[model samples]
Target: MSDYICNWDHCKFEGTKNLAIRHVIITHAPPEKVPYFCTLCSFRATNLKAFERHLTTFRQHILLEKENSQTKEYLQISTESYNVTWGNRNCDLTLKNEKYLYPEPNIVPVLLEINEDYTVYNETIIESTASQTEENNENIEKLKTKHKREMNNLAEYIIRLEKKLSARDQEIFELKRELRCNEPFIQGFNEMWEDQVRDKKEQRDRKREDWRRGKVAKENMEPLGETFSSPPSKKMKSLVKKLF
Candidate 1:
């Protein structure tokens, strides 16, 4: 990575070797044919295409640097002279001796200022108008798209909820109908249980009465048997013998 040096005056510029070479080709060379030497880098371009391509990339940098320096420093422009220095030692160019070399304009210092208020205002207004218009258009499109999607989703949700609610109502109705159908069977079971309890109680009462009567008869028979087996009393025995 060699540092970039402007070929114009051998002054070093802040760039890579490749960029420097590109700058040289684009800024100084002719379109169809290569220049014998580069105006900025002093490196020669063999073909015009390479030169044009180099200039296209380097031109922006050159213009920006010139614009920045034009305020603080003066530019040395000479139509008569091929070699001229621009803004200190950063940029220098040498042109071939041609009719365009000694053109009408000579090197002069330019004073920079922001004097035109109306032009600035007009430019600002135009830029603001364009930006606002673009933003509004974008917002409107987004809103329309978003509204359509939300409406669709809401419609689907409502339909699904309605289906769920209907199913629930149907289940409740079926449960109520089942309860009503079972009412008669439940009443019949209650009646049969009451009848069975009444019959059992009556049978138990009859058995208890028969046991009491048998106990009384057994007591009376024991006394009669004992008397028949016993001897008679003394007085009674005498009476009985006389009678016999």
Candidate 2:
């Protein structure tokens, strides 16, 4: 057998060329026919955005290079290109990358406290404080809304199914009713057919009996003119001789 090898790193699948091609086509390529190959890993996506997400969010290659957290060091903050970190380690930023105009860390507050009709901001912590409480509430509300919507949709679907089932059942009932109504007519037809067969049999038997009786009578009958006692003549003698 010819060797068909998958060149993707960490992949152990080896087969014939056709099998390897089939496996790649089925596993890596999407049905939409777009090719999105991952630069770092064996993962393939259907579109560029999906490939980018796979590169940043699901960084299988980046995580492979990540050392154990026992070693601690200050990592620089990159501003030129946005990148998601690999592990659960924090990086102390001394200077931002050249992408951002501001030297200080870009701060965007997620949640604002309304104090006497004025929005208050906490300057110390950059990013959203909403991650502490509001995020969970929002998630819970979204889940509830989604669940309710799904339930309503399911209920509507069930109602449609029930309606169809009811209509089908009604149609079946009507067919059964029609069959029941025709039962008497079917029975009458069967009885008429049986009666006709019986009558024909009786007529055939009567004919056979009549024929047998006529044959017996004919066999028992005397010769022609035997019952008439006439004078002994040459003509009668000749007729008797001929009949005998």
Candidate 3:
């Protein structure tokens, strides 16, 4: 660290190098004098690095200093710039120049007129902004309501679809159960049909055998009748008599 000059002029207080540096940064660099203002608290800093640190501290102090006049004004300025960049740009030169060279003839009168114009414009803007804000809020509320309705409809549709799917699944499950229950009956019916067919074939075979036996008996009877009807031969008869 380097030796630092006491920010207070005519003060013979020689401090340690670090202490002197801190004093210069806290007192001289602060916004009370200029050339090294802290961006945060607007306090003057002796060095750029110190100003940067002060800015950080100022950010930390934002919530605490929110009600502070200086802090509130700064915040308002920042907010105003954010709201309307074009207007802010147009006013930038006036704000910077008004602080310097105040009593000059042309500049002073022009500055006053410009300030008056800015005030009038700002008032008009505020009035219009209030109405616009109300309209925007109404639109936002309507949008939120519509979104909620749509979400509810979607949820209901999903629930209905789930119920339908459950019903379909139950139907499928029942069909499977019925198929299982009928499997044994179907098998038994097939077995019975086969048995009936076998029985029919056996009956047909028995009828054919009976028809063949009747045909053979008729043929034998005819031959026996013809033989019996014809008389015995004379020689056969004579030989029969001698043997008796």
Candidate 4:
């Protein structure tokens, strides 16, 4: 068998020349000066390959809490615009609340106001003169009664439409309330998985250290027969003489 001996000074390591060189290098190095530093933990590695292995097994996550402080800014409608749009519109609705008109009472029919939203509020007035007091007066009275009934029907139809719109706006408001929130969900972390990985790595490192120590001890101590070996005694000489 061929023997490969290490040529390093005072190094009796006989198998791998590189292992002896590494041992000598580590022995002279400062105890506190380890090669790889883990930014997440206190663990340090001896070599680049070990450092990379350590990183893969001992990786950790950093927790960061972000503040959810942003809020939506909505335009506030001016009072004047509100009055012209909704309030003033209601003023005309109030006038239409009492649509009946009488010539003797000087109650003029409501004048129609056409709004930007295409809604029209109407007013109509009629007058009877003393000179036109003829037989057609009764027919005119019938016409007035018919017009009044038609106006009442139109008013009720508009009111029902407005009520439906109000109900739709209420539904929209409820949906918006349900969707609004002050806090938002963030990314999750798994503590149990990280802990398991850490424990497994620790077990592997401990076993490796124990195996290395045993190998070094075996190399340094000689075998039992080799340690006690000597020249043959008188009994060994007689046995050899008789055999001859």
Predicted structure with the largest lDDT when compared to the true one: 1
lDDT of all predictions: 0.47, 0.46, 0.46, 0.40
Candidate 3 wrong stretches, greater than 4 Å: 1-124, 187-244
What count of clashes does model 2 give? Answer: 0
Per-residue lDDT for 7-34 in model 2, tens only? 3334444455444443333253332221
Clashing pairs in 1: 7-41, 8-40, 26-54, 26-55, 27-55, 79-101
- TM-score of predicted structure 2: 0.27
lDDT of 3 by residue, 168-241 (tens): 99999999999899999989999999999999999999999999999998876757767889999999899999
Better of 1 and 2 by lDDT: 1
Go through the candidates in order and give the C-alpha RMSD of each one to the true structure: 19.2, 22.5, 19.0, 55.0
Ranking by lDDT: 1, 2, 3, 4
Q: Tens digits of per-residue lDDT for model 4 on 46-111? A: 344443443343212111112211111111111111111111222211122222221121222232
- Of candidate 2, the 10-residue stretch with the lowest lDDT total is 91-100
| Per-prediction TM-score to the true structure, in the order listed | 0.27, 0.27, 0.31, 0.20
Instruction: Candidate 1: list runs displaced more than 4 Å.
Output: 1-125, 189-244
State residue 95's C-alpha deviation in candidate 1, in Å.
Answer: 40
Clashing pairs in 4: 109-124, 110-123
